[model samples]
Target: MHSSLNDHMTLLKEIAEFLNEETEMETMLQGALKKLLTRSVFASGWIFFIDGKGKHKLIAAENLPPALMENDCRSMKRGGCWCVSRYHNGELQKASNIIECQRIEQARRQSEKSSGEITHHATVPLQSGKEKFGLLNVATPNTIEYDQSELALLESIAFQIGSAIKRIHLTRQEQEIALVQERNRLARDLHDSVNQLLFSVTLTSRGAMEMTEDMELRDAFHDIHQLTQEALTEMRALIWQLRPKGLETGLLEGIKGYAEMLGIHVVTHVSGVIQLPSRIEETIFRIVQEGLNNIRKHAGTNQAELFLTVNSTDVLVILKDDGRGFHAGKIPGTLASVGMQSMRERAQAVEGTIEWISAPSEGTEVFVRIPY
Candidate 1:
């Protein structure tokens, strides 16, 4: 009998191990209850989870139809109803008969009144540490009574269920920690990258202003010098916007600012959302900046479209231009020295990805997605 009880404990642990890896808490609880009932050969069993209103939610049960599992109340007199009070007081028990139960007077009173057969019962409460999560109920006919061994088996199973609950809680905590670390890395990379690029452009502009002499040539040089200065300014603005400003004012204002400076046809779509994390919003902004730069330099188109989608766990940004395009597969140059590489690095830094669509004459499209 000791050997058999040990085997039961092993089975209990196996069931809990299976449930612990599940993402949905509801599914894990139901699976644990199902396995418990099947292993013990109980005449009846039930699992109840507590709700916000302190009501019991019938998560799973045996000897009860699916729809009837919840919202069904039997008379307190029947041997069937000793569970509520036992659960309320946090008791685990193994009894040969309901008459021998500690609360026999109450059990008998309800049993006699319900007109239902008396059944032997064995039960245990499920918990994580000191918190009582719920109760497990099991019953058998009087002839098939519970011995000390059976009671021990029920206790072992309850421990396994509790362990699984704790494991899942730990997993979610780990995922959140990982997310925060990735965000910090991205913020650092953006600061390093944009600052260097803008600084070089600034110095180049200042040098050109001091080196020119011919009136017409100086004017042309001045125009180019101003263009470089503007690029530096754009880089600074893009960096500021990526640093986690609120969704409504930050992105909308940034887009409007870009439109005014570019002096081209720029249309933005609100689509189905707003509000994005600094890391995520920054990646999208960089991808757009790169795509438009490539268009202005290579494609010669004046009109562009920018679209953003912020959903439950992801942010998607798309920038499309009606300008001449080129082969992206043959992209050459270090990411830091080139626009395409910078965009890809920014996307990767924030747990995001980028996709490029372009041809020699059909224009270009840059699609970026960041998962938060």
Candidate 2:
């Protein structure tokens, strides 16, 4: 009994240290599950993350029999099981004996080969106080009952996992808040200092153009006025990029506002609701901003077309302009400009794809698709 107690204490200490040290959510969960199954009596273990929308994702697993591991754990991925149903219904409150494993039973019925000795498992709600994250389950071969001490240990581990998840989420939220604050501060500084100075220069140059009488002096003043106005426009664009004003309303509105700021007329069409995570919204907004800026500078026309389609699975955007187009094939090796490279990198960062289509005379189109 003394030896068992010592082992349990050591396991708890190691797990606590691991959880505290790991910052990433998926890596932490997978590593912790591996530790539990290896050092403990449990023959197999798995974790499920159920979001507020009731979507269930199998986060991690270990020591699964051939049956459950088939087809990338398809048996575990789809359909509702007893424990998960209880979880969704708010009935599972502690580590307790759940019904015979539905996944095992299904696997048995489907395949003639022996499915494994495991039939029943303990289900524990992974929760920190009132907020619940998901469920953790562990099982052993031929096990039908779990002792009070074992159940208590499972509960303790579940609690640790829950607390770690909460801590990681809060840290990310705090970081995001800090980043927004910094961006706002920079935007304010540019607007107050550099932006105002550029405006003043534009006005002074325009006045000089009107006051000059010599032809060459007048032309010089006119050139200065034009350059100053262009500089002021670019400064405003930079400020808007730092703190996009219409992004709070919606992504479409934000894109429209940006195009307007760049003096480009965009005809937009939308298919679905324009709601997305902030990161995705920011990415798409910046890509469209770059596209519009290119149209304003190189397209020889300020008119553009934007098509946005968002569905349950993915988001698609196409921005097209009627401009003198270049050879798309030649762009990869010869004309890979920084703007094009930046747009491609942003799309790839979101696990998305972006392409440019153009010819010598035909218009240019930028196509972007990002999966949810």
Candidate 3:
């Protein structure tokens, strides 16, 4: 009995340390579940994170038999099982024996043999205080029941997981708040100092050009005025990127405003209503910004076309320009020096794909597809 208690204590200590060190939500959950199964009697374990809505996501899973593992764990990813239904209805409150695994039962019905050699499992509601997150499930091959001591151990581990989740969430919120504050501060400083100086220079240069009578002096003033105007436009675009002030209104309008600031005449055709998550919206906006900047600098064209198509599965964005397109082989050194690589990286960050299509004198087209 003493040895068993010591083992449980050791397991709990290890789990607590692991959870405390992990700041990423998915990593923490997956690692905790793996550790729990390796140290305990459970042969397999999985975590389900269900929101206020009935939608469920399989966050982590381990050591699944062929039936459950088939078709990319299709059975686990879909349908509401008994425990999830109970969770939605406020009935599952603590660690208890779930009479039968609904997923396994369904798999068994379709298979000739037992699915995972398992029929029942134990589930504990992962919660902190009055707030509930989801469920943690564990099972052994052919296990049908769990004793009070086992249920109590599961509950303790569940509590640790829940607390860790809350801590990670709160930390992320604080970091995001700090980041926004910093961005806004920088935007204000740039607007007040550099932005104003560029505007003043533009006005002074234009006035000097108008006042001058000598051709050479007038030409010099004209060049200064044009340079200052371009500088102001670039500064405004940078400020907009830093703060993204009008993104709350709509992403298309935000993109248009950024393009206009860069002195590009953009004609946009949007197929569907533009509603996207903030991260997606930001990624798309940055890509579009980069595309327009390229059109302004290298494409040798002041006009561009943007086509956006939103469907149930994915979003498609096409930016096209009828400008002096360069040789395809030479584009690596040309566009890569600009923000082409940065645009690709941004698209990859959102699990999307980006491609460039261009040829000499034919023009350039940027294609981006992202699934939500």
- On TM-score, the candidate that comes out on top is 2
lDDT of predicted model 2: 0.87
Residue range 1-372, candidate 1, lDDT tens digits: 677767787777778677766777678777776776676656566666542223455666565322222224232222323454556655533222333333323444544343124334555777777766666656654533566777777777776676666676678779866865675566567668866766776677567767866677767767776786777656555553444333346776665455445555678886666766665665566567666656555668878888888777678888888787767676633541388877888888876898888877887788888876
Q: In model 1, which range of ten residues has the least summed lDDT?
A: 68-77
lDDT of each residue in 1-372, candidate 2, tens digit only = 678778778888889999999999999999999998888888888999986656578998988888888888888999888988889888999998886988889977776656678888899999888999999999998899788878888999999999999999899999999988999999999999999998888888888878888889889988888898898888888888889989899898889998888888899999999777888889999988877777776667888999999998779999999887778877533223567888999999987999999986687899999865
Candidate 3, residues 1-372: lDDT per residue as tens digits?
A: 688678888999999999999999999999999998898888888889887765678988988777887778888999879999899889999998988989988877766644768888899989888888899999899789988878888999999999998998789989988998999999999999999999999999999999989999999999999999888888888888788866778887788887877778889898987777777888998998888878887888888999999986679999999998766556546554568888999999977999888887889999999977
Which pairs of residues clash in candidate 1, taking residues 3 or more apart in a chain or in different chains? 77-110, 77-111, 244-278
Span of ten consecutive residues with least summed lDDT in model 2: 330-339
Q: After aligning candidate 3 to the native by TM-score, how far in Å is the CA of 366 from where it should be?
A: 2.7
RMSD of each: 13.8, 4.1, 4.5
Give the alpha-carbon lDDT of every model.
Answer: 0.62, 0.87, 0.87
lDDT of 3 at 99: 89
Q: Supply the TM-score for candidate 2.
A: 0.78
